[model samples]
Target chain A: MAETTAPAMAPARPALDETLLAALAAAAGDESGGLTRRLAAQVRYEAAETPSRVRHLWRFTDPARLLPMNLTAVTGAPGDVSHTLAPSVAGAAATIDLWPGLPPVVALSDDLPAGQLTVVSAGETAGSPALAADELFAALNEAAWNTGIGLAVADGARLPGPIHVRVHASAAASLPRLRLVVGRNAEAMLVEQHLDGGPETRVTGHTAITVGDGSRVRHAIVQVWGQGTNGHLSVSTKAGADADVLTVFGVFGGDEAKLEVRTDLAGKGSRSEIVGVTLVTGKQHGDVHTTHRHLAEHTSSRIDFKAVAAEHARSTYTGLIRIEDQAHHCEAYQENRNLLLSDRARADAIPELEIHNQEVSCSHGATIAPVDPEQLFYLASRGLEHGEAVSLVVGGFLENTMAKLPDDVRTMAEAFVGPRLAAIREGSA
Target chain B: MSDALLNPANPANVFACRNLHVFVKDGDQEKEIVRGVDLTVQRGQKHALMGPNGSGKSTLAAALMGHPSYRVEGEIWLNGERVDALEPHERARRGMFLSFQYPVAVPGVTVANFLRASLAARRGTEIPVRAFRQELNEAFATMGIDPSFITRYLNDGFSGGEKKKLEILQMLLLKPAFSLLDETDSGLDIDALKVVSDGINQASGPDNGLLLVTHYQRILNHVQPDVVHVFMSGRLVRTGGMELVTALEERGYDWLTDEAAVAEGSRT
Candidate 1:
């Protein structure tokens, strides 16, 4: 299948002035052979039109709301954030600090495998394809990103411990990028966490991963921004023959957040599992979209996304599964369940499937409902108060998705979710 | 009636309800399901309220437990406290328990976690982890349940017998002062029946009272009832000893219904 690129024919729009581009270029310290790619990305961002509100991808969330407003880039100091590192295996791991309007500070561990893992200013890494520069946000991230980490795992290298990356954005507007490539028969786990931002902060992040034949990868992205921040993040993956990819998303914060994840199965016997848990409370709004495209035979994919909204908060989920004409004997299933905690809280779910092959099996289901009254009654009959019953039911609603997270990350997510549920109960009371 | 029987505060009685009327909304009309039931269960007594289908036995039991779907009128006293105005959980905390006819499934809640939370609420303190686990293991063994069921979701995909067993397990763990088992014998095979009957027998003691609301007399063969009452048309018409169960099993409830109808005709 031909690589689908963002449409080149876009309406003319006012581009960022040359002075801002110069400022970005100077801040990026473009001596690392990334100037040309950044320039091309800028051109694409300038040419691309804002997504139309009628487009299905942008229907639930207004694109204009995500556009970074009257905010200028500010240099971030290392003291502004704190980080911890605990790598499971004796492999090299790097930490890249991304503060807008400043060159990234890259620190590598003592045991660095030369050329296997490198931190670059921009462009592709480890023979991985460059950022698609297609969508408006992708192009913007590629053009303005201040930090990038590229990791390439050699064939047969199995890393039992996960490579954890944590980014805390203190700048008014922040952009961070990552590129990963897993070789044949390799096994790797990556956890990327976006944590801690000011009330007025805005974040835009992009990550691309390429899985070689017979590889297995587990990737989790957890975002816990401030209650008044805005976050937009996109992650895309392409899996080769017999490659298995499991992706988990935990969206717990941000006043208004939009997340998009896409997976392309380009080889036979490849499979993907996408799981997401989003908790919104106290007037927050969250929108998530996912797509799984099958381009090879005997490929399969499943998506399970759950959301809980409380206290006038709202959450939306849109998922799509597409099987190409030649992709035979493929199986795809998608399920979305939303639990509303208050009459004022709301949720929306949209699931779609496009199967071109007659031999494929595809199914999708979506439900948006308040906590089941019968379930509440049953729990109450067991001596649980109404508030306790609500919390238990809400916690159970997200348990399946939370179970997919690693132990430490699951603990962190529970700590974040527990209070939100309690707040909801208190608000209702 | 003796003054002691009318006084709900009598020490000998573990549970009592007076002039209890349960009404449920059916569209725009208020339909009475349990009409003015007055009964008292003494300590150490097992009472069986047998009735035909649609006799409002389940409604009466639910109303007694303070289910919110029904509007209950009258007095419900448990362990010397008037509990008619309390919520279901409040009533439960005051030593009232009801085993539902059709227990709802709570997905993703493991039986162990649910049981722990319930015990915590009942005891007003978190049970020690090791002690709770030991007690749970003992209960599982007594109920003949596989230990793996502790990790399974609470009644999510459980079969009929499993659900009933879980209800009984909860009763034994919580050790309520008064238990209302509404049709707990329905949808059980002979083997499940004996197991459930044994669980019921184990949960009953001299300190507590049991009200077994069932439509069949088969379970009576295992757990003997000191008092048997015939419920028909939203009220109990006859209260007697073991002879009532023996007579109903042979002649069915039609004869009792006819007698109750004649009595109602005379009253009107």
Candidate 2:
């Protein structure tokens, strides 16, 4: 049995100042609209109580670790943001540059067809529904987001390639927000990456995605922060009738990180699939939580999450599926598998299901174990070296989930996970 | 070790083992499973080691292949090179292969990918994708396996017959100089048995040696053996031609065990 240690006392939660909130609201244009939303979010953030460790969502990770030590925000100078456009989507997609304490600058490609897509500052879309304020970090992001963007795709627009959004943290504390609205019968792929933060940087992010009826959306969030950086992210998605949504979440770099995803099947015959892959080595830590709520009849959802832990790294996964009484004839499946590559590496998995209707079919399973020796021996007997055999096994373990990603995203994931798997020694466990 | 045993007079001697003893750890005690034994197989020669259950026939084959669980104290030579000290993969790279009685399943790894990697490791270079795919397709046709199995995980959720056929398929790909088939025919049906036997025959040639370990004589009907050795109580007691297999089938193993006991008593 592994040794047990007493839990460390939680750090103090960072305070939110009304003066700073007002300043941020003023800098974000559309004073009448943005200020009202910011003030409401600030009130919600202050009114909410700190979550206790007893809550399953906050059980493995301490919320205080996600809070930045300093409360000051850093605003980048003009022209500090860099952007890249893939050739395939060069004509169809537009780029939006967001910086703290400045209005967003939108650049439309010359070949972009009129009325096909709308790229604008989030402050202009003030009538859009506000993000849920029950969570601490999400409310913090809503109240003090320094960088924000809103993207709207016209109905029946099919993008040739994925739109890329790269968020670079320029300071110790940063808040980023993104809102996406897909029109009916449209198809779009979005890739959001978090990068360029230092060891002590702490980032809080919130993303809200709304899909229209009979539409398909593929969204991927790849987080590759510095070795000692801390990140907290929340993603909430809602699907219309017959809409299909696929979300891929990849975590490769960070000292401490947490991601929470919630998908609501609000339309009849809608479907949602969520795939997550996390690789942690050394003393890094990763925690992921997902919830699928079926609100309409004939809705379905599937969640598959896998994590590989090496050295002394630790990973935690908790997934829940809830079927309401009105959600008759719904199907939900959740699976979480963890691979431990070292004797010191650790993994924890919790799968939960709640069904209020007898007509629903729901199943969930979780497994945590080290690599099988028989598997290694079998590969070795086929002439592969020990290192090569181990690499093959680990790669295969992640391939099932990674294969579901977009082509470019899958390549990026391999670039991040391949080297870490190669560095592991034979029989290190 | 005598010079004659180390360097056999016949240059065609493809595989030879001298006084091989295998021990497995059970808790804190070392349990001897394979008593000291000597055997030799020349090129184009097929040998069958017949024994009853719990007689350690599988242990000898595994120990000869350098399985990490067994403590082997003996010399195993393949193609005139000693390999007992090498790792299993190293031995495999040097033309040694073992078809396990119970093949393990590797989830998330496709059969095509595994075969490509194995071929690459054996040849010391990556095989071209197109050529590899063509070869895999041909092998699949010969093994009577569906081409769809190429994309399926290796042996995962495979039936008993399918697993056995895959083992033979691997043999056809690796083309080891010496192949030790441990109970390859145990769970195979009649049709699967014939197909696997045909695959084994196709892989065997004038330059390689074959050693089949089994407790049943059914598989021998498909793949004939040139030499048959009766194993009892972890030792090879009698070695002869095909007559031994027929005798064991008609008379069973009790008579052989009685004679072997008397012979051991007199020698001691």
Candidate 3:
């Protein structure tokens, strides 16, 4: 496939201030006219024409840069801001930002880069319709994304600790997109946490990650938006030969949340594992969808998801494991388990297998269950009160699934899921 | 009923069941399981209730322990207090213990924790861990049971003999004022039976009264009941001293019919 870049385009609204574009150009460190042109062609120019509720709201403003970092150049225009985010082996100034909002909002500066790892943190205030879309684009375009953390470590190069990026929204409405890139023969762990300020906040974000040959990356996203907050995440990963990728998506607190993760094993001898756990209650809805494409020979992938629903809550899971013709000798496995703690709770599981290669092995299974009365009575008879008995049994039930995780992964899983399950049990009681 | 036996001022008797009649629901009707029977165990006395299978000896013990399934039509007094209306745990709180013939297993809860919880429920205070452990270790040593058993799930994965020994261990820790040993020797070998009987004898004090429920004389030979009562047709037809246990052992329950007939004839 050829490396493609979009064309440059004029502004949709002539009156939209060119000063914002000038600031964005300055933030795009390269200052190359071709790069700026490439950034403009990919944007939805007419999106700025959406009807506005308030003129003071400034819904149709052009994409602007509020702050600039010197580490990487951004060639793209306001429409699609593209810059490189590379780890500073010698400790460089690593921060980036877009235009500040009309109203004062909590803004977090990008983190200082550590050995072979870089971090970016930001908060955006979004509003009705067009502002929401604009805020999403602004956050994505403002990242120091030049050459995008490009590095090709030698085979068997071990990257130490996780590269942590925190996307925080302190407004009633915000959309933040955090992106990351990894290199060949290098290993990296990335943790992203989505925290909200209020119930009315709405977030839509996308993270694009790529792994190089003989490298491994473990990525995790923990979403805890308050009541009425809607959280959406779209993640994409590409693995090379002998590369391993693991992703844990935990959804605990949200009015309604949908997490979609897609992984592509583009080379042979690669493995990708997707694991997720969700706890929802009080009319809450949780949706976890994963797509695994085995595009190379001798690649393998596995997906496991567990959810607990209570008090009229609903959970839906849709997963796909596909092995293409070129991916012969591939193995894929998928499983989903749901525990319903109340009669009104509901769970829906969808597992699909699409195999074009006859030499591949693939399997999928799902299960939904209510609390076992016999187990409850057994615990109660042993002098644990009814509540404690149920708690212990529930803990045991979830622990069985956790036993399959590695040490660090298991600790992360427990820290993310344990308190939420406990809270649900307490709320039901 | 004589006034002397019924008087609350009488301090000699620890438990008195007067004409106690128990019934069980058979299909849609309440069928009598324990006919009219008067039994008394004096303070510090250890007596045995021996009978054939289906003779309602266990029903009497259940009635004394306030089993919800057993409905009594008579009065039961424990230590001068009427206990016919109490619940099982309430009766247990009042220093009553019943060692089940078949104990239920509970997984994930250690035996020591269960014992401490039950003891706390009875004593209404937090027991010091050091004191509790000391007493538990002592009880285990006396009963010849391994100390590791206390750390396991209550009765879970335990053998029949181990379950029986655990029951005795619980009895020792709780120190009930009165205990009903229901076929404690049913599944035990001779050595286990001896160890269990010895544990019971060591735990039983001057203030604790016991009623042993069994079908055989094997346990009685080791425990040495102060009195023996033979139950038949849901009623006790004969009550006697140690000699009576020997008689029942020598001739079996066949002589009980002749002995009952002669007693009735002489009374007439």
Candidate 4:
């Protein structure tokens, strides 16, 4: 696969230093800098072998936990993210990009209805911290991230389009934290993209979404990285009474990519649809762990994840659906399908359900198998080469997951990941 | 075994196959499916190869089409050009087409998209959307097939008869110089058979060649063949005109097998 060439648009910024990260991650700042203290502690905790609460082969280890020194936090006015936002979505909505060398930049459209949309830094708004203090991975991200973007939509307000966030990982580790709050009866869409960084760039990203009563939110997160990068990304969403959330996760490519997502439906009549797809090639390892917890009465949840692993790559998926005791009339379903493209590729899926409510309905299914040979020959006999046929099958599998995304976001996602998919196929061939 | 079969080139031939043998691997063992086949199709000619079940007729067609699963061990000449070493798509690009007996389905791929891509690859240029749509609609209407099938997944969930019709629709749209139909009439009713025959006739003009492989003589009635050859046990036993097809319909393949047996006994 072609190693992603670092985007040349980055302007002159403070050069990255090796010792700077060691110093920032090693020091426990004063009590006034409590966030820094927590970050320092989290960095140290990452050095040791910390067992993952979720059991699997994707246990995290040896990854840089602290934000890199000189990480750009682009904030306010035109920023780097505005440039990367696809032209199709450029003028549709407010755009932002969190660069490693600048502060989190946010540019809201002035022509929109007043009080309809608002964006603030974590300190400016009284937004609830999504990650608990005990969740070390997410806690460190929340504490150390300098680009914590807080979004709020007014009650009964409908956004014209989606908020596009393009984050560029740097040579050093970056902790990106997001807090989104959709007000009552409001609707919004969020398209978050993770762009590739340098060969040594390590990224740890965390996002928390809160859907208000009777509100709807559709979030699509796509990860596109370099050949020598390490990534740990987690997204946790909460839905309120009568609220709906459709979230799609597309893990396009990386050297070592670990994605964990959780959706908690705590309000009555809340619904959640979670879909994801991953493309793993080379010797990369891609893992996705998702959990859907139905904690309220009359709530429903659906989870579908698909992965295509080729070359010596490996894909692991573990999903669980937990219905609490108080949640009656809950309906939940979880399905995982993996396509292994070669003999060297490997895939494993584990789906589980825990229903404490006796009167609930829940089911989980998983399938892990090689790509169908019959389909390959069929396409090949029609004049496509074997490689092209395999590539088409893999692409169709990935595109099926995009059906959950909005039309604009899906188009952008395809434009973003299509070339990377071609690279994956090339490497496998 | 014969000098005629060993000759690899026929300048006036649209497609010439010389001593072609195809083998496929069953588990770890190599099995020769098409023992040896020599065929030649001239311009504007239709040759029918009829045989019973398991006679390797379809295997020979697949081998000539350059299917990867079959290891071909003979020279293939198309329009006086050597092309046995080429891949299937290469053969297709050089104007060779084979209508599969059981065309495989490609889920999530629409027939319109598949045809557009195949046409583009075959012609080495992009076809405008409007032009492509017009061509597809015309072909669909000509085949008596529903236009909605164009948007449906390619051959996915298609009925047996529908799949056969779609294959002929592709053959009509592609218009290859040399076409091989392997049991194209397998799942067609009388009406569809007539439509498909009309489509075939439209393609078989003065420049293109057609070979219709079938176990029954029902299709031969509509699409008359210039030459009819009876193939038994992977070898061509007899060749004649339309009278041979009538004879086979009247007596079946047993007579040909019995004649072959007697000829073998006499040789011994």
Candidate 5:
């Protein structure tokens, strides 16, 4: 695939002010141009559009209101971060490393098979996204997407183990798009990890997944995108006939994260399971918006999202189950639950369902509640202090959804969440 | 509870509650669950509070631990220090433990991790991981619990026998200054009851006190009680030795409630 530098010619809209763009560019060190360029595209497409109000949390406004994207994240200093597979699980046959301004670094193991990887431009994705790129950051990612990864697993092959994809985002706007294409009757798992150093890191990530007929695929996005980074991600998936797709989002640390995930069941008898676990504390804000669309007969999808927020932290969840007219005999369910860990912590849950066919079975439920008192009492009466008990509860709350993640990915997620919950407990205590 | 470890100069009692009353909100009113109850458990003494269902035995145990759901009044002293004003966790830090009748499930927290955290909090320091694991494994073996319980979530989806065994397992691990066992054997099978009773016996010593809140005397046969208190209508209507448990088992609680009514009738 040829790299296209020429902008896709299209109708003009409101673009970012020249002065503001220049300031954004000047404030960003090595990442200035990319930030300004993406912001420009964002302003052009989304600045004036009216946003849907059904599941809105934070107010969307000018780029000036976003968490800072101009500061630079220190890169690869000693003790910063390492890009490698976990020590316990060692069977990765191939690895892909991504960062800003650097070509993707790929290394193959001795057991790697042929035609497992390729590269393609954004325009070449076979089907349109079921979820529109109308959100400001999502739109910006689309208008500015220059490179993406294409992973193909052959029929009846299981890749031996997961393929590790390490993404390094800077304080500037680092937008990465990934497409995992599992061939017919294949099985595979992808573990995508995000790493950044912060005080003011900004990241916008996008992922596309397509599971071929009768195939099974597990995709995990582990976001340790800096302790105080501002980030956004959108995941779009399509499942073929008789295919099974599982997507897990393990969000650890970020100042503010807006995640949008949508799964499309377009083939008969296809199954999709979307799961997410988010841990936020101490002035951080995380929002998750997900949609499961059943577009074919006998399709089914289950969406489970759980979050823990503490010490002035806030979390918002909005999930939708949409069933079309021809999608009869389908089953779809969405459940969102939040645990408040401090007096100042807040959670908002909104579940929506849109069914065009009465024959379809679609249901949605949401709950925002304090940690269960009985659970706390049981732990505390066992000699755990309040903070320790709360930490245990918070860990448990987040892991209900984490159990769906691949084993290695689950371990990584636990490593990030355990300390985070402990920190939150200490802060509150 | 054993009477073998009492110190004369100091307060030898492991736990004492004087005129304790507990009220919980029901609709628009505070309904009293424990009314004017006085109890004392000396170090090395095993006392059983036996009563029928809804007779406030569990409420007394809960109130003794300072459960937030109930408004507790009067004085509760543990190891000579008054702890009525303490939070449940604070009371726990002071070496008080309540084996819940219905232990809540903490869905994703593994049993081993939960026990380790609790033990650390009780000890005021961290327990080494390897040592903690070894101790937990031993407890599991003693309680006749499968090794898989170490990784399973606390009380989450456990069978009745498993949950009951876990309560005793935790009691053994924490080894509080005073442990209140609330209906710990109600849900256990015959073999499970024996295992739980044996674990409780192992956790017991002269330096600590054990208070068993039970509705059946079947478990008392396994873990013998030195003192027995008959509870009825949210109050201690009668107190005696192990003979009281045998009497209640043979005669039931009707006579206790009848005696209270006659006493009130004559006083009025």
Candidate 6:
């Protein structure tokens, strides 16, 4: 039998911060923000409970409601903040290291939200312009944003090297928010990763990216957290006209995790391809939710996600591809495939397509299957014992999805997958 | 357990089955398909089992290979080792091979890769990449198969003749101690049949025993058998030399059945 590792216990929940709680209650009563306002109110009410030791276990199990709540809470954190709004910032910007262990946040000239793009360096400037926005100022409040690695490219500029961002949870936990924008005709590759190491392992993060017209961006996020850590990743992207975005998202390590990815193809000829794979075992609960919006005509999107569940572990995949009415001639496809290795393991895949445009082409497929006996027999007949045969088949199955990853990330993914399969085999035996 | 009953006449007789009876279960009733049949194949012996449809030829082959669908009341020995308790693939790893009438199509796995895996399992070791390729090429050449077919999905999109040839190729690579060729000549043309028969003859030698099951005497012409057994009503009624195949071809299965009924009537 495999050695049974004990589950790490997180510190009990903290008492409600009555001051923040009251602010949320008042904001909920206001009519302006609509859903955003209502959500703020709900989070306040939930936080009104007496101090308990839950530590967001509820969030781990139920991400549908908890993810947005966690976002509001993270954005509401009290502290120093840096960074600003922009219409377009040009050529050879400086490095703004907001959070060291966090992945780099590189914003192209087009990524600005309809205003002059700015960068305020909390750390030494590598060489770039800094501009701050009113909304960011208010959202950031008095908290000067802890600067993360930042780089800026000029309008119609195309840079070659991949910008690397790394986020780490220090001895004191902190919530960091990143807003990245790319400009029209600008192109760059962004590699963001979260690495946690400290006595205080519980940390949260929120990341939002915007891709502009005639621009292209490739984003890769790999999260490898320490044991007992609770990791929550919420990422949203907006693609512009004739723009292209490709994301290879990975979640390799965490005790309890919830990851949400939402992408909007907001303009014509916009395209996005997202591929992800997670290996979850033991009592770990890994939840992945993706919402893809094809909001304009001739937009194309494709998503493929796979997971392997074993032991008493559970994995849930919820994918939604929505094609709006104006998105005519849009093409969207989503597929979720999973392999279950034990009777105690559970996996749920909900692939949904909400198409409002009659001229659009959309399809979603999901499959949950155990190992094939004939394939197993064929391998076993080649003299592989049953376990070794199962290992080869499982590895081969996951390799199909892993092949979709880029070379650099593919090597790291194999390291994570290899041990997960071994642990699963040992657990079953 | 019982002095390991020795067959001194044929030391190469690697497989033997005694009083083999098999039944098909339907609802609550069981209908026997193989009735008290005894058969033996010495090593290097190319034997043919000729029978009409539904006369239990395939059932016997399946029973010997340990297919789960049939229930048997018998003893089967391979290399003087009891094998009725082993699974089909286990029987295979122990050097028993079956060329199905219709080979299963396994998608996403190439024919050459499948053969290498089977060979590895049979030998309990990994076959080196270079050596495996060389052997695969030799097998394909022996069976007159194009090299491109090795990279395609196993038996998928293959013509009937091509599937038969691939099956022979697998047999040659796996090289089982005892082989069951089940209806290998069912869907072949005259020319294809000769090529297939030649491949089978080249693969079968002094060390391996084969039970070639067929319904027609046409295949027998290309690959003459030392002994031919006739199946009737799920029973091996008569066993004789090559003359039995010729006689049955000149007459028919009904000729033999009618004679059996007459003899039974006279006895009563």
Expressed as tens digits, the lDDT of each residue in A49-80 for candidate 1 is 77865556766676656656543445556544
Q: Candidate 3 lDDT, tens digit per residue, A6-42? A: 2323323212123444443344232345234424422
Per-model lDDT: 0.81, 0.82, 0.65, 0.74, 0.75, 0.66
Clash pairs detected, candidate 1:
none
lDDT of 1 by residue, B220-261 (tens): 999999999988889889999889998998999999888999
**Candidate no. 2 TM-score:** 0.90
TM-score of each: 0.93, 0.90, 0.57, 0.85, 0.82, 0.73
Kindly indicate the candidate among 1 and 4 with the higher lDDT: 1
Q: How would the candidate models be sorted by DockQ, starting from the highest?
A: 1, 2, 5, 4, 6, 3
| Ranking of candidates on lDDT, top first | 2, 1, 5, 4, 6, 3
Give the best candidate by TM-score: 1
lDDT of 5 by residue, A342-367 (tens): 78988877677889988987777888
Q: A201-299, model 4: which lDDT tens digit per residue? A: 667678878889999999988887666777778888888999999988878656777787888897899999998878777787887888788889999
TM-score of candidate 6 to 2 decimals? 0.73
Model 5 chain A: which ten-residue window has the lowest total lDDT? A1-10
Candidate 1, overall lDDT? 0.81
List, residue by residue over A1-429, the lDDT tens digit for candidate 6.
122333433324322343443343232221223234334433543443321223222323532211111222222221122211110112322222234223334444333334234442222212211211112111221121222332344467666445545555432333444556778898866666555533335444555667888889887676666666665666677888999998887776666676767888987999999989877777777878787888889999999898877667788787888888888999999988887777887777877778886998888889887766666654543444566556656766666567787665666566567776675545453
Q: Between candidates 3 and 5, which one is better according to lDDT?
A: 5
Q: Is candidate 4 or candidate 6 better by TM-score?
A: 4
Off by over 4 Å in 1: A1-15, A29-33, A80-97, A105-116, A125-134, A422-429
**Candidate 3 segments whose C-alpha is farther than 4 A from its true place:** A1-115, A118-156, A213-216, A261-269, A272-275, A290-304, A319-335, A350-365, A402-428, B1-268
Candidate 4 clash total? Answer: 14
Model 6 residue runs over 4 Å out of place are A1-60, A63-180, A191-203, A222-230, A250-252, A420-429, B1-11, B21-37, B50-63, B67-73, B87-89, B101-113, B148-164, B186-195, B216-219, B230-268
TM-score-superior candidate, 1 or 6: 1
